[model samples]
Target chain A: MQETPRIRMLLGLADDALIHGHRLSEWTGHAPTLEEELALANIALDLIGQARALYQATGLPEDDLAYLRDPHQFRNVLIAELPNGDFAFTIARLLLVATAADLAWRDAATSDDSDLPAIAAMARNEIAYHIRHAADWLIRLGDGTEESHRRSQNALDALWPYTGELTVGIDRSAWLGAIEAVLERATLTHPADGWMQGGGRDGRHTEHLGHLLAEMQILPRSHPGATW
Target chain B: MTNTPLWEVFVRARNGLAHKHVGSVHAADATMALQAARDVYTRRGEGLSLWVVPSNAIVASDPTDREMLFEPTGSKIYRHPTFYEVPEEVGHM
Candidate 1:
């Protein structure tokens, strides 16, 4: 399909939500504690819900778009597709992505040319909670014991390169301020700026996205007519 | 799971109602505990507001003394307001 800019932007956001939500859902039976499991699952559900809205705005059934997309067709930033390393790594990535998402959705909600203001509006509310949840976890992990602090710092350093790709529908400075404030409170040093990565929006992604898509689309592709 | 403390969660369903003890969550601190409470208890919109406290901080009555304390109050008919014979004009009182 030859998508207009608006529809493309919507699909990109939808991809981000769906892929990141899937990553979070991977923690379903594996989180360290029951409460943490519930928390991650709840946030995952919220992201997937946002994905559904954006997919609908593109005039396609959400399941079809989500379950049938090829790796090259997905437009989620590489950051969202990265493996959840450790608990600290998960929190660090979520803090960055949720902050960026909050900014992106806030801008999309008020844009005069937006076709679905309501989708962005609801997304803003959901991302607000996601930002807080991720920030709190990051702070505790970063400022915590020797092992946790080291892990948090390492995750931030590793994930810093992909933060550049999040500016698709938002300003870097606006979102960076929020991320830096949380880093300051977390007592974690922000990684010095260096080479930045991009191209996901144009369908170029890391090897991780391919593996992720295969795992995500397997059931749907394998059993085309399967139903509950 | 790294020896995180447990917290007791209370949720108020609406304004003008007291927060009722709903459940518990494990968190490293109060903020995480409160956020966890929101995720664990209010996902279905069951709460209007929430409070989370360290589970150890709560001073619960000893269950072993239940027979000596609550059982005494249960049989005290004098504590019953129904003992009073009021005229119909007294209304709810």
Candidate 2:
């Protein structure tokens, strides 16, 4: 079957949101404090919401797109599936992704495409909070206790490999150039080329994704059409 | 490893309005308390101003004393001017 370019692009977005939301949800009941737990949960919910909107627009049920797919079918980059290593690591990951996602969505919200702009606008406000919160924690953790500083730096180093594919914008997508320009304006430093990793978008996932899907999909797959 | 105390949240929705009780959250300190309150309470833009008080520092009136403390204000009928008749041109009165 010939895949439409729109479906493929939308799949990339939904997959990214699904994988990252699953990763963030791992911090639930285990964050450094009650406030942090709530924050992570709220961010996860927003990502899930974005994924649902994108998936539904792409002509698929969000549940089927999120839970029914096999691990090999997922197009999310490898970084989103990596395990949450520590509090600092989690914050660091959030800092990086939220900053980039925030930039990308800002451009998306202003795109020539009608529906895409509206969806991106709605997502931008929530993503702003996610970026600020994560960046605040990054500064605190990076400058705080000896342990915290070390952990965050290590997290950045570890996650540095997957940064490249995130910026590999789809050539046919009109918003790519604008989004890249906005992200560049932020002046956030990504690691050098030798350090940048790959394989998430190619459907080559990390070892972590299987376990992540098994757990995230269990309830929905088992229930099959259950709704609140 | 950090044991930050809980904080009480109060929100002021508009400039002329009084700050009212909201809820509480545990934070590393007061600054973080304010940030957390903003994230948790104002995510939907519910507030224009916020105050974070350490949970331990708040003093309270007894719940059992509610009638004695609040009833007196309600019983003062003369506090309101129900009997007054206003002239037609006195619009606000």
Candidate 3:
């Protein structure tokens, strides 16, 4: 069957959620506090839920799509696959990605495609909370003590370059404006536009994604054709 | 951090119901406390609403004063709903 642009878009969104959700789940036991650990894990579960719905919409078994796909077949943007560095880095990355996702899902909720719009509508409420959670952390960490402020600023600067890839082929003004407003309130500086990294949407990714996929795919691959 | 305050959580299971104390979580502020409550106490779809208040805000009668505070109610059998009998035709009432 010929794939529609809608299917491609759905795949991109799903892959982004799946990969980032995996990274977020990695913090299950290691977060700064028990409350934070639960919060991050909850957010991770929400993303994975979104991914499962998107995968099901494609008329394939969700597990097959998630666990059997090749690395190059993924369509998530570059930002979603980056390493979770410090807590500051994770917050910075989430703030940027969740903001973009909130905008994208808000638009997708009204899309002409049947499954995409319904899935988007169902997922929008969850994404809204994710955005708020990330935004709250960003503001707190950025405006916090001297060490926190320094670390947050560094994370923002380091991750800023990858964000441009998210803006491609989408109306970026809303995303940029939302991010600017948060940065302003948080007292964090936005990096000036310069050289921007690209290519994850085209199946080219950093080494981090490959390592992540290896761990995630191990169980399913080791037990091919086995069902619980 | 240990310095973070503890907040007691209450969850309302449905509309027209009172929020009942469920558990406690630690957070730096009310906003984080609310988020923590939603994440911890409501994960099983157990709530229609949530409230988180700082633990210190609550004033409880001393445990040593249990007899003074609560023991008297136990002996008041007349206060029990079963103490009165309704005709069978009254059914639910």
Worst 10 contiguous positions by lDDT, candidate 3 chain B: B76-85
Off by over 4 Å in 1: B81-93
List model 3 lDDT by residue over A1-228, tens digit each.
Answer: 335776677788999999999999999889998888888899899999999999888887789888988888888988888888899999889889988888788778777876888888878898888888888888988888999899999999999899888877666888889988888878999889889998888889988999999999999999997877
Q: Give the clashing residue pairs of candidate 2, or none.
A: A78-A200, A161-A197
As for model 3, its CA RMSD to the true structure in angstroms is: 1.5
Deviation of model 2 at A149, angstroms? 0.9
Q: What's model 3's lDDT at A226? A: 81
**A5-75, model 1: which lDDT tens digit per residue?**
87788888999999999999999999988888999999899999989888988987777888887888888
* Candidate 3 residue pairs in backbone clash: none
Best by TM-score: 3
Worst lDDT 10-window in candidate 2 chain B: B37-46
Interface RMSD of 1: 1.0
Model-by-model lDDT, in order?
0.87, 0.76, 0.88
Kindly report the docking quality category of candidate 3: high
When just chain B is superposed on the true chain B, each candidate scores a TM-score of 0.84, 0.72, 0.88
Candidates ranked by TM-score: 3, 1, 2
For each candidate, report its DockQ versus the true two-chain complex. 0.78, 0.38, 0.82
Tens-place lDDT digits, model 2, residues A122-221: 7888788887777667767766777777776777668776767876663313323433343344323334446567777667887889999999899888
Q: Score candidate 3 by DockQ.
A: 0.82
Ten contiguous residues with the weakest lDDT in model 2 chain A: A170-179
